[model samples]
Target chain A: MTTWDGAAAAERVAIISDQDVVRVRQLVRTLAVAVKLSLVDQTKIVTAASELARNTLVYGGGGNAEVSRVDNGRKPGIRIVFADEGPGIPDLDLALTDGYTTGGGMGLGLSGARRLVDEFEIDTEVGKGTTISVTKWCR
Target chain B: MERVPVLKIGDILLVSIQIDMEDQVALQLQEDLADKIVVTGCHGVIIDISALDIVDSFVGRTLATIASVSKVLDADTVVVGMRPAVAITLVELGLSLPGIRTALNVELGMKLLAQEREQYELDLEDEDEEPAVSTR
Candidate 1:
């Protein structure tokens, strides 16, 4: 259980299993509607959530996520934070590259998920863990 | 292990992915689809993903694989009801789903399959006649 600023997140969930991927997608849908994101934005962010959730389970070896309604003084947005304490990534550049995978995926999870969001952030340690946070603003 | 139901309509297989699939379930659905296509001798497969709001890489690859697998089995696959957002995300994700056909809805998907089938039969007939002429 990683500690996060719950003040930012209106809801949170765990991502410890394969099925949790689906649950996280569902949770994203809920937040998407709550934030009244357009249908396209909703799908994009939800799809992003699906990718990150799978990464949390498969690569990060299970983690947790938080969804929050955020404002940057310009527009309202929904922020997603995925944190995990699994075997931390040793190489951030390789991990972010398209078609790069330690796991047997197409290597689109990280790069692809990045394209679908408005803002993306990544923090990782060699032995500790990784934390990824993203935002999708309502247009 | 949740299995997506495969419904047979005439000689066509209808697979609607209504729920977000686990990895196991997605793989299972792929296997089951292959079996169903063979068992039913389906000439066409229409996969409806309208209910799928979010298509991650896994799901996207599963769909692409399903399309190619059905083609190898001599069946046409038409993915239907792809939301605009899903399509945009797939392209950005570098999943073009090449060689896989898509339509706006099931009705249009069925139409595409029918057109493909007709063209295939026409090509077959043309080949048959060409062999006769060459042999003569």
Candidate 2:
């Protein structure tokens, strides 16, 4: 099991509007670069954050994203958690399936975000909300 | 709402996306491009995305929509200057950006647009020369 050390840096950005999504992307990119991730990895994580952030805003009806720089015993990584108090995902499997979307999107947000990050976790309830945590470690 | 500017050079409309655009902004740019295509009577549209660090699904879809919209307006659209890293990430994200033509840089994209225009003119001339020749 991988255990993360305390975050060296952290920030939260609201995902309530379209511009907030862009801000989330910028925040993730800054943290990814600070973590010393490769260019491709940085791009991947930032893109994933953009997708998830949009999901928070569009489908979740509004949310927040927390970006953090963390370290395991040997390597540094960036982790982002997106949380929203909107309609929870009814079907986790279907939500993770590519081309499956309830929000009129391309259905690539969840699945594509999973492919981009090294670690992914989701917590949700039917009436409560959804929180997705994704991490990309330096290699 | 910040707007992406569209500049006209010769018969082509050039759009260099310099901002980290919001979703609404992306859609707005698509509408603006469609209008510009008709107003300028351009034959081609070149969208330069070199400044963009990442092209997520929304932006990718927007670009494809812009390409298809331009096609309906009788203009070819070429997306140019995608960074190597962005390309790798976009492919991994399962977005191949279908229906949108791409080039390495603006210069090459311009060349492609010119070639496409020349080919179109040639095809038109061929049709005019032999009206009975089957277009199939």
Candidate 3:
């Protein structure tokens, strides 16, 4: 439904709804400066962002994308979490592998996101929902 | 907290898009980019799609359009981070773009920008020098 910076933190952005992929990317564009993400990295993040948003819209029926800054004392990074309450991926392992998509895309949404970021994680329950987290560090 | 949140940097001016070597969206992106460059004066543009699982004719045409438009706008363009499988698919499909600048990764695309900028500056200097020489 909307994309806004965190309620309490300026660095965080919460995107709600199936149509918020563009909004999430817009948020990323705004934060690119502080994050120092390269032009290519930005595209990678946006592409994955768009894919995830679409997945929620098409498959999950709706969901939210949450983004925030991450710090581990040494490096600063961007963290994005996508949550959807759809049917969930039936095969987690096959779904993560490239060239194995049931959807119309290149089947690289999850894999591509993994490749683009420094860290990637996914959790799903067949009947419950799915949550994916990805992070890219800024040096 | 009532703090006004403003985008700190300049509209995140630079963005490189990597589309499947053959996607119709790529062409639309070209038109979209042309308009942005005309209005915003952005510097970075990278289009890398190494994980493209498919490449069709429409996608091919779109890629060509994006390359051509970006060049006309004097924007730096780089086709980087292409997946080998995708590349093979494109080649097998015989899809090719005439003038899209290409590199292996986003890093290479950034390097290309440096070179392109230097060339642009030198061309401007040449134009400036020519006017002075003609006066004498």
Candidate 4:
């Protein structure tokens, strides 16, 4: 359904601390700009990456984020995958709902991140792990 | 942790964020602002964020908290210089930042604070002019 440019085009950043969240935003911005996304689109993806990256650290107990260029035959896009081996989300539906959060956050991280990107996919298993992938296509 | 400097200009505190703020840094700024408000007894705070690339939920929430804290300390807070792209993304993320005042730039923000200070002084004067009637 989706294709990437190559393995070499991907960059991985560790999401272990608060500083890592800032790193994630920077990485996403660089990749988004390289793909020639609009300025607004670049901001959107960077913000979404920051949210997801923080989720990985605070909720997932640390993780890794992979950023790469994607292609869907029509145009080039940016795709980011955040993978974590910590406790997975028990309630996917509740987690996706706005204003619902186990953490003390505003509960807008997951839902807001989803809204900022064009494609969002989540894979999780209770007590196992969680992986969230999002893509933003150039317009 | 790196700290954001808060400069005092007259009765207003100015903070121009010039770094990619981490969570700890944001929290530190909040605490620092509260302390500075008490020590300096400033009437207004203007936070400049034009240099920030993105304002996520964490940053947005922090700004709102700072505004509330400043209000409780009897000071008005005005966030200024949000990039157009950041504003669009913030709206899309469903963070309207209610109860927090915003301005296009520092000059406008300063103007707003000055007007608020004037109105506050007028209200105090009116209260002082009120005749007190106490029943013995």
State each model's CA lDDT, in order. Answer: 0.86, 0.91, 0.59, 0.93
Per-residue alpha-carbon lDDT of candidate 4 for residues A1-139, written as tens digits (9 for 90 to 100): 1233463488899999998998888888888888889999999999999999999999999999999988888989999999999999999999999989988999999999999999999999989899999999998
Which ten-residue region of model 2 chain A has the weakest summed lDDT? A1-10
Q: Which consecutive 10 residues in model 3 chain A have the weakest lDDT in total?
A: A1-10
Candidate 2 CAPRI assessment class = high
Ranking under lDDT, best-scoring first?
A: 4, 2, 1, 3
Candidate with maximal lDDT: 4
TM-score of chain A of each: 0.90, 0.93, 0.82, 0.94
Give fnat (model 2).
0.92
- Residue pairs clashing in model 2 are none
Residue B94 C-alpha lDDT in model 1: 79
Candidate 2, residue A49: lDDT: 94
Tens-digit lDDT track of model 4 for B67-123: 999999999999999999999999999999999999999999999998898778766
| Model 4 CA deviation exceeding 4 Å by range | A1-8, B127-136
Candidate 3's displacement at residue B66, Å, is 12
The DockQ assigned to candidate 1 is 0.72
- C-alpha displacement of A21 in model 1, angstroms? 1.1
Error (Å) of candidate 3 at residue B35 is 22
User: Whose DockQ is greatest here?
Assistant: 2
Q: Tens digits of per-residue lDDT for model 2 on A60-133?
A: 88999999888898999999999999989889998999999887888999999999999999998878889999
How well does candidate 4 reproduce the true complex, by DockQ? 0.81
Instruction: Rank the models by DockQ, top first.
Output: 2, 4, 1, 3
By DockQ thresholds, what CAPRI class is model 1? medium
| TM-score per model over all chains | 0.89, 0.93, 0.50, 0.94
